[model samples]
Target: MLWFLFCLALLLGGYYIYGSFVEKVFGIKKQRQTPAYEKEDGVDYVAMSTPKVYLVQLLNIAGVGPIFGPIMGALYGPAAMLWIVFGCIFAGGVHDYFSGMLSVRNGGASVPSITGKYLGNNAKHFMNIFALVLLLLVGVVFVSAPAGMITNLVNEQTDMNVSLMSMVAIIFAYYVVATIVPVDKIIGRFYPFFGALLIFMSVGLITAVVVSSEHTLLGDYELSQMFVNMNPNDLPLWPALFITIACGAISGFHATQSPLMARCIENEENGRFVFYGAMIGEGAIALIWCALALSFFGSVEALSDVVATGGPGAVVYEASFGLLGVFGGILAFLGVVILPITSGDTAFRSSRLILAEYFNMNQKTMRNRLLMALPLFVLGGILTQVDFGIIWRYFGFANQTTAVMMLWTATAYLARHNKFHWIATVPAMFMTAVVITFILNNSSLGFGLAMQTSTIIGILATVVITVYVLTKSKRDLFVNEDGNAIDDDGIEVVAQDS
Candidate 1:
C-alpha cells in the first residue's frame, strides 16, 4: 500500500511540476514563431495532431530500457520495484519531458545542442562524444540482450537450431529495412502498428500467464534476502540505489528519445502529455516485467539457470508465456523479436539525426544514412556474439555514469531556469552525488587515487567554465562589437524577435 502511494505521489508530482514548467517554456512568445525549418510539410515538420504525437511519443520511448531495467531492478527485490516505478514518474519522466520541450524551444536541437547552448562549445563537444559512445554501448547491449533472449525462446519451444534461430531473427532486420528504407512515409505509418502489437502481445501474455498459474506468488523468498546476499563491505543501499538507478531512475537514452520525439510533436501543448505520459507508460511496463519476473522465477538460482540455459530473452518469454503451451511460445517470440528491432531502429534513427545535424548532411539521402548506420549495426552484431555478461556490466556502469551527466545537466538547467521543483532536483542531486561518492569510495587506494585526481580535474574544468559563463553573463560581455551575444559555438547569438 505504501509502495502504491509513493509511486502515485511521484507520478502526480512529476506531471504537475514538470507539466507546469513545459507550459511556461513554450509560453515564451518567441516560441510561437515557427522557425523556417519547421515550416516544412506537415507530414514531417509542421505540427502534428496531439493524438498522433502522443502515439508516436509513446511508441518511440517504450523500448528495451523498460524491459531490462525492471528485470534487473527486481534483482534488488520487490522493494526496489517501488523505487523503480516511482523514479520513472518523478525523475525519468520529468527529465525526458523537459528535455523535449527544451529541444523544441531551440528549433528541434538535440540534447548536446542544449548542453552547448548553456555549457559552451567544449562542453558541447564532450557531451556529443559522450552521447555517441553511450548510444553505441546501449545499441550493443540492448540488441544482444533481446536477441539472446529470443534465440533461447526459439530453441526451447521448437526443435529449431540455436544458430538457425539467430539467423531468422537477423533476417527480420531486412523486414525492418523494408519498413524504414523509405524512411519518411513507411516508418511513420507502420512503426505504430509494430508498437501496438508489442503492447498487446506483452499484456496478453502476462494475463495468460497469470490466469493459468496455480499459485499467486512463485517464491517464498523475502525482499531482505537481496541485501543480505550482497557484499557487506560494498557500498550501502543509498549509494547502490543511486548508482544502479539506470535500470529504474533516469537514463541518458531519454535524452536521445526526447529530440527524436520532439520532431514528431503536433502541438506545443501536447509535449507534456506525450513525453511524460510515455514515461508513465514505461513505468507501468517496468512494473509488469518485475511482476512477471517475481511470479515466474522461484529463486535467484532458478532464474540464473533459465537465463544461462535459454538466454535472458528466452527465459523471459518462456516464463512469461510458458503457461499457454505452444500458443504462448509464439506470443513470447513475437514480443522478444519486436523488442530489439524497435530499439535498434530508434537508436539508428537517433544516431543518424545527430550526424545529419552536426555534419549538415542531406536529409533526403537514405543511402547515406544507411551507410552511416551500417557500421554501428555491424559493430553491435559482432559484439552480440561475445560474452554478454562482461559487455552488460561495462554497459551498465557506463550507461549509469552517462545518466548522471544528464541528471546534472538537467539539474543545472532547472536551477538556472529558477524552476527548482525539489521533487525532481532532490532525487537527481541525491542520486548523482551518491553515485560519484560510491565510485570514489569503493575503489582500491591506487585506482581510487587516480580516479579521484581525474574527478577533481573534471570538476575544476566544469567549475572554471561555469564561472566564465557567469562572469560573462553579469558583465554582458557575451555580446560582440556588433552587440550580439555568443551562442553555443561562441559564435554570435541571434534571437529572432517575437
Candidate 2:
C-alpha cells in the first residue's frame, strides 16, 4: 500500500509540478488563437472543448497499451512503478505536451511537417516514412487483436455467422468510413462515452484492490530489490524494461496520436490540461495494473511464473476476474477491446492527414479522403495475416525511435527560442541510449551485438546526437527581419498564426 500510494502521488504531483513547468517554458499564451479556431475545415480541424479533447487524446494514446505493457513489465519487479511514474511525468507527458503544442503552433500540421521546420528537410522526410509505417502497424495490430477477440466472444456465446477474417473485413469497412468522415461524426461522438467506460473499468479494478479483504496487492515486494532488475529471466533492464513498458511510460506512438486532438484543442492555454493530464491518467492506469499483478499473485516469483505461463492476455484475464468477479471481468474485457478502435481509426486518419500534407492535398472532400485511406485499409487487412509477434517487436522499435526523433525536434524547437533545451534534451538522450542498447542486445530483432559493446556504442551515439543538435541550433539563432525563421531556402513560414 505504501509503494502503490506513493506511485499514485508521484503521478499526480508531477502533473502539477513538472507539467506546470513545461507549460510555463512553452509560454502557453492565452490571447493567441489555436488551430481549432483558425483552421476550421470541419473534416479534421473541427474545434472542441478542452475536456472532450483530453478524453479523445487519452483514449487515442492509451487504449490497452498502459494495461498490456505494465502487466508484462511487472515481471521486471517494482522498478515498473518508477518507470510508469517518472517516465510518464518527465518523458511521456512532456513529449505529448510539446508534440501537441508544436502542432498547434504549426497550424495543426502532422508531426512530419513540424519536424521539417525544426530538424531540416532530411529529418522531415524520415518522419514521413516513420509515421506512415508506425501508423500502419498500429492499424494492423489494433485491427487483428479486436477482430480475434470478437470472434472468440461469438464462438463462446452463439454459433455466430462470423469468422476472424470476415470480422477483420467488417472492421476495415468501419475504419474507411471513420477515416474519411469529419472528426465530429464518428470518432468525436464515440470517444467520450467509450473513454468514460474505460476510466470506470480502470477505477473499478483500483477500488477492488484497495477494498478487498480476500486479496491484497501491496507490500509483497520490497522497493530495494524491485529497483535492481529482479527479472527471473535475467533480462537486462536497459532496453527490455523500457521497451516492455513503452506505452505506459513513454511512447513515440503518443506523439503521433496527439495531432488528432491538436486539431480540436480550443485554446493554447488548454494544452496542459489536454496533453499532460491525459498522460498522467494513463500513467495511473499502468501503475494500478502493475500493482495488481505484483501483489495479487502472492509473490514476485509467483507472478512471474503466471506471466511466463499465460503471457500478457492471460495475466489480464486473471487479474480482471480474479479481483473484480465475473461481471467485472466482462467490463474489463470490453474496455480493453474497445480502446484500440479509437486509436486504430485515428492511426488510419493520421496516415491520411500526413499523406495529404505531404502533397498539399485538400481533405475536406470525400474523394481525396478515400484515395488516401483505401490503400491503407487494404494494406492493414493484408498485414493481419502475418504473425503478430514479429510485427509487435518491430512496432516496439519504431515506437521508441520515433519518440527519439520527436524529442530531438522538440529540443531544437526550444533551443531556437533560447529556453532551457535540456528539459527535452536530457530525456531525448536517455531514450537515444535505450533504443541503441535495445537494437544491440536484441540482435535477432536488430543488430546482433554484445551487451558491453552495445552499452559503449549507446553512450557514444548519445554524445554524437547532443553535439549535432547543439551545433545545428547555433546556426538557427537568427530570424529574418520579419521574425520568420531563415532557412537555406529563405524565410520559411512554420509558425501558426493561431
Question: Each model's number of backbone clashes?
Answer: 3, 0
Question: For candidate 1, what is the total of clashing residue pairs?
Answer: 3
- What's the residue-level lDDT of 107 in candidate 2? 87
lDDT, model 1, position 332: 56
State in Å the error of residue 43, model 2. 0.8
- Best of the candidates, lDDT: 2
- List, residue by residue over 1-498, the lDDT tens digit for candidate 1: 233345546666666776566455334333454322464433335455556555556656665666665665555556656676657766777677767767776777777787776556776788787777666666666566655666666677689877743653574375346423643465566666776776676676567545664534434555455334222233345545544546445666777767765766655666667777767666666666665665677555555566556545645666656655677667756665666566556666676667666787655566766666676566656766666676665555566655555555555454344343344455555555544555555453113534455455445554553455444333533446886655333544334310
For model 2, how does the per-residue alpha-carbon lDDT over 241-353 read when each residue is reduced to its tens digit?
88889889898888888998988988888999899899999998899888888878866688878867756666777777778777777788778788777889899999999
Q: How much lDDT does each candidate structure score? A: 0.59, 0.84
Error of 2 at 480 (Å): 6.4
Residue 62 of model 2 has an lDDT of 84
TM-score of each: 0.77, 0.94
